[model samples]
Target: MVRGLTVLCWAVATPGLLWAAVRLLGVERGPLVQLLAFTPYVAGWSLLPVALSLALRRWWPAGVAAVAAVALIAVVAPRAFGGGSPAGGGGPTLRVLTANLLAGAGDAPTLVRLVRERQVDVLAVQEFTPEAAARLDASGLAELMPHRRLNPVAGTEGSGLYSRFPLTATGVRENPGGFTQAYGTLTAPGAAPATVESVHPAAPYSLGQLRAWERDLDAQPRATPGGPIRILAGDFNATLDHAPLRRLIASGYRDAADATGAGLAGTWGPYLPDQRHSSDRVPAIRRMAARITGDRIPPVTIDHVLVDRRVGVRDVSVLRLPGSDHRPVYAELALPRAELGG
Candidate 1:
């Protein structure tokens, strides 16, 4: 009877454990609330499974182990194959990259290196400084990409937009707190007009600040003079599972990265390298290292490139760039010509 009961408890908790793991992967959607939603799942799988195994020390414990393994496997599968290339047919695809440069953090060289390697078509940078901007310009990135919009905030942590196509200044608006959010009209070679907003909003860590940021985003007008093919990129400082993120989605924006299934790609919290650290700190730093290596919160993803639902994403990636705590997020979106009403 004791052994049977243990097996039952194990079976009951297995699904929850699986859910917790999956929740952990998807937790960044809501940094404060939904992020904590999987706490029960972690407790059940991490502690309860071992406790049940010990209590029910018997032949059936083997069955419990099997169930646990199956549960874990099920949770990780979505992140693995979720963002593959579309099966049969698709339209012209454009690669978009978004990065929070951490005020340049001595990472200009690496950023330049990544740009060349990735062949990024459209680049959105947050926390940009004039010096860093000059460094990128010196690297000849501005010449290579050509089309650009640089916010004149003149700080280490400002925002800017760059593209491989021609650009015309559409509008520029500063939030009430003075952060510059620039919107530009990009004329890609053959695609429809894309209204890209390079925004660097204040981190809405508190309830009051979050509400303000939410209000500010709501005020930004949608794409004009063409169909509504919009791209909101930069360091949003809010997670998707959060209320603000929910609002954006419900209001018709889709996370190009997450929607294309790049849920496991975490892009924040000190993944960069420095010469000062000893090898011991490196070895002992499992949790931080895991967040970087594991690519999930515990590393947060305050940086994003979200598109309206009308667009289709072909590929999404997080570039492991040096200098910033956050990685550069990349998305390949296929905006069908037919979808535009010109």
Candidate 2:
């Protein structure tokens, strides 16, 4: 009986050890991509296996579980505490916000109210529809953010950018992932010019689209340390745990949420009991992922605002609105000197 119980402890620790291996190696593929988003939760539970093995007086299982627990904690613990790079060159603070409106269905007044209350200087929007654009305009979005470059269509492919500052060299480009990305050069007074892109990468909904999702992430331009300051903001459909996003960040961008220790806040699936998940309209994979994560929060932080490393991150927060699964991500950034972007 003792031997059988020890075997059970080994079984419990094995999956977590595999998870740690996949995460550490960045080898998670297909549906595993969705599951890897739950790394933080798994890291917390890893302690249980260690305790159980030790209590059962099984040294081998205990050692393995302790190794897995340490590895998981090393990967996940840093995000919960703040100590991001202080790279700002002492320029003006730029308040930026990004949100995905869920195909014209998200509440427009609430978005406008967030902008008004938050004093957002730049706003990046994904899943923007023409009707939603008109609704936002009707709700007095133009009064707050007069300058704009929008490509609002009827479906999830549309994207847009609105700013209090002027936008130049503005255009909409269809990314390989089948989403329209709105981008432009933003000129803020007393600070350098920043090129901002509204990002909406293809979600790896199925095994077939996985390549497309990878292409989308790969196509996202890396931050140019020697060139213009850049900010990529919106529903990336990928999280910090993903390898491609990690590569993107390594190329010179800083995740606002991760910088401020809000990285663990679930951004995608609130995963409630009610049919309220009905409103979010996520695909079967996400719903399954919700179940895998115990159908509660559903390991997710897909929406992000990644800024150039030259900028200093002051604060990051998440805000909610009705009818959208993704909440708005707001970041307070201090841009570098005016010449850094030139």
Candidate 1 per-residue C-alpha lDDT over 74-114 given as tens digits, one digit per residue, 9 for 90 to 100: 54445435644432116556678787765554366677677
Q: TM-scores for all candidates?
A: 0.69, 0.92
Residue 68 error for model 1, in Å?
Answer: 17
Per-residue lDDT for 1-342 in model 2, tens only? Answer: 987998899999898899999999999898898788888889999999999998988889888989999999998887888666567737788999999987766778989999999999999999899888999999999999999999998778999999999999999989887899999888788899999999998988778988998899989979999888899999998888899899899999988888888888777776322225344544344345546664556647899999898888988998886657678899999998786654
lDDT of each: 0.62, 0.85
After superposition of all CA atoms, the RMSD between model 2 and the true structure is 3.0
